[model samples]
Target: MSRLFPFHGGLKTVRHKTESNQQAIRPAPVPRRLVVPLRQHIGAIAKPLVQPGDRVLKGQMIGQAEGYISAAVHAPTSGVVTALDQRPVPHPSGLADWCVTVESDGEERWVERKPVDYHRLHPSELRNLLRNAGVVGLGGAAFPSAVKLNLSGHCDRLETLILNGAECEPWITCDDRLMRERAAGIVAGLHIIAHLLEPREVLIGIEDDKPEAIAAMTAACAGTGYQVRVVPTRYPSGSVKQLVKLLTGRETPVDGLPVDVGVQCFNVATAHTIHRAVDYGEPVISRVVTVTGQVRQPGNVEALLGTPFVELVELCGGYQDGVERLIMGGPMMGFALHGDEVPVTKATNCILAASAEQLTPDRPVMPCIRCGACVDVCPANLLPQQLYWHARAKEFDKAQDYHLFSCIECGCCSYVCPSRIPLVQYYRYAKNEIWAQEKEKQKAELARQRHQARLERLEREKQEREAKLRQKAPPRSEPAVAKPTLETAVARAKTSPAPTLETTAETVNRDG
Candidate 1:
């Protein structure tokens, strides 16, 4: 048995997973209109490839990946492009972004797919293929899988590869249901990942709360030298850093990634997508979503990308009477959505229609008692109290001094705080402020550089004009034959005036 290590400070929150994981994954009905956002993944938003009135087939690339860190966006079904304009998307900020709205043709026609023999292709080719296929982590991070798969500068060789099935948050069971039903496909995808990475060992981490998933994954991993390790049921264990610590006993650097610790982690859903993309030539047009809480039928659905949250809720028999808020992801880390009309993206894993009973009561804020409750439960082992104080004061540098970025926004501190303070919100605010300041700095620097370049260009042009004028100037003609002054002319005239008329007549006769 592989030795498992424990990490510091985690909460044993209520697992409301059974509400959604009890049934098999259902395929969601394609909506009449799908509003797919171009900014699904973490990096640059994808560039739109289709415009209004263009007909597109299912699995067609609708948005091309824009950068090395981005992923492509594909058509969820055969459709006609209706609008490529700014529309509401699923984000905590409640902002609109550029999206491709498609009206389904009801044909479900697919573009011709060319599945490749991954083993024969170069690693770069395979990664590019995955990028074009829109493969990204489905564990809510939605990081491009191609970027993670490339282990270029992180280490000499990968030591461990962890497939995260530890869907440890409350009321989210998309991953749990995926593992229970599609373990084989996931493992097959794992094989492709292993082929590319060639890690020394493979470990799948599932929370102990998910026995069926554990058993299913274990069975699928048999004979493949991959081990399914059931970690203790703890809040935020599904987090990459915490899961890495639990599985490998290695600490990821606060300023670095898991690969910096010679480990790489991928969501099991991501691996399954890899399998579909490589072996089956399918792009990531859909994902399994858990829709529960204040709904008539709480279950998991394989929802197409851009399917509205309202549609999924309706599919699950719509909302219950007392539905107070619509949240994306789980209660611990998820944010409440502005409305259910927002479209699902690659980052969406759960649609929680929370009621007053399901949500924490809106308790009045109280002064901190300095009881140290938050410190005791912080999984990252940071001083959350200090962070909160600094963040609330708008002392962003002080918050950074407290290692605020290391907090992971896991909400454990907020959960344990006696003051009922929304500590996470303050941290998020501070982080955003800091980011905005940095962007302003970058813009200032860029403008300064441009001004300097313009000045230099003007100076060069001025010098060139001076040089050209000098070259075009006429040369002096031997001092202009020394023109006589008035005095010299008068003196010369006095000496020769007596014979002037005679000389003039003689000169004229000689010339004639």
Candidate 2:
């Protein structure tokens, strides 16, 4: 048994996990229409590869990875591309994004798959393969897994690799069910990751609430030298930084990644996708999602990417009465959706249909009592009250001084606030404003650079034109004759002198 370390400032919230994890994972039926978003992963949005009216096979790359930090987007099922246009996507802002709307042909046909042996392939090739396969962290961060696998500048050698099985969010149990049902597959995927990183030690972190998942993972890790460490059931323990601290006693830098601490963490679901991608030659076309809260049937479903949330709700026997809000993730960190029409993306892990009873009541906002409750429960060890003040005051720089970005927006602070202040919302607002300001600054800087370049280009062109004129003109023959000046004219008049009258009389006589 590996010893566990504790992180500071976490909440012991109610775990509504049993409501969803009781049942086995079910495969969701393909929807009649699938709306796939291209910007599912963290970096540049995948570039569209197909146009309207194109027939695509299931798992075919519909959007190719755009950059080193991007993941590909694929067809969820064999379908005809009906439209490549804007559609509502699963986001907190409830904004629409570019999507590939496909009308399923009901064929469910897949493209050719060629699995490779990881042992024989180079790490770069393996990372590239996973990148093309669209494998990202299904832990809800949805960061491209391929980018995490590369340890180039992060560290000389990886010390620890942690598989985060601690689905610590309330009412989210996709990872729990996945661990219970597909532990071996997850282990298989971890093997590939371990091969790539060659970490000194491999550890799997699970919360104490999940005994069955811990046992299942332990059994699967037998003879593999991987240790499954069960942490205390704490909200936000599943977060990378906290989990890293819990499993390895390493403090990830506030502005750096786990790799900066000689550790790297990935969600267990991400590992499973790696297994599927490398061993089965399949891409990330689907994921297991927890449909819980105010739902008729609360369970986990292996939902296809681009499948509408409504279809998964239907699969779970639809919504129960008093379903007040439809959220795309756990109540703690998830954002409420505008509607269920939005398609599931790589980042989606749960569909929470929260009823009034399941949700925190909308109490009137009151002034802060300075109770220090929020400060006590902030998992990131931040002064929540100060952050709230700064954020609410729109003092963004002060919020950054309070390490605003370090706050994971896990909602622990808000959950404990005595004033019922939506502290997290304020932080989010501040962060968004900061991001918007940063983007504007970047745009302004880019424009300035372009304008400077244009001015330089014009100056260079002007110089080139002058040089050409100088070269094209004929050379002066004899340093062209000088015009007679005042002094020269006076001198010439004196020299030409009195050839006048006397000379003129002699000249006239000769003429006569």
Question: Against the true structure, whose lDDT is highest?
Answer: 1
lDDT of 2 by residue, 80-118 (tens): 999999999999888999999999999899999888999
Per-residue lDDT of model 1, residues 440-478, tens digit only: 999999999999999999798667755654544322222
Candidate 2, 377: how far from true, in Å?
Answer: 0.7
Whole-structure CA lDDT of model 1:
0.92
- Per-residue lDDT for 1 in model 2? 65
Q: Which residue ranges in model 2 land beyond 4 Å of their true spot?
A: 453-512
| Stretches of model 1 off by over 4 angstroms after superposition | 463-512
What Cα-based lDDT does every candidate model obtain?
0.92, 0.91
Worst 10 residues of 2 by lDDT: 471-480
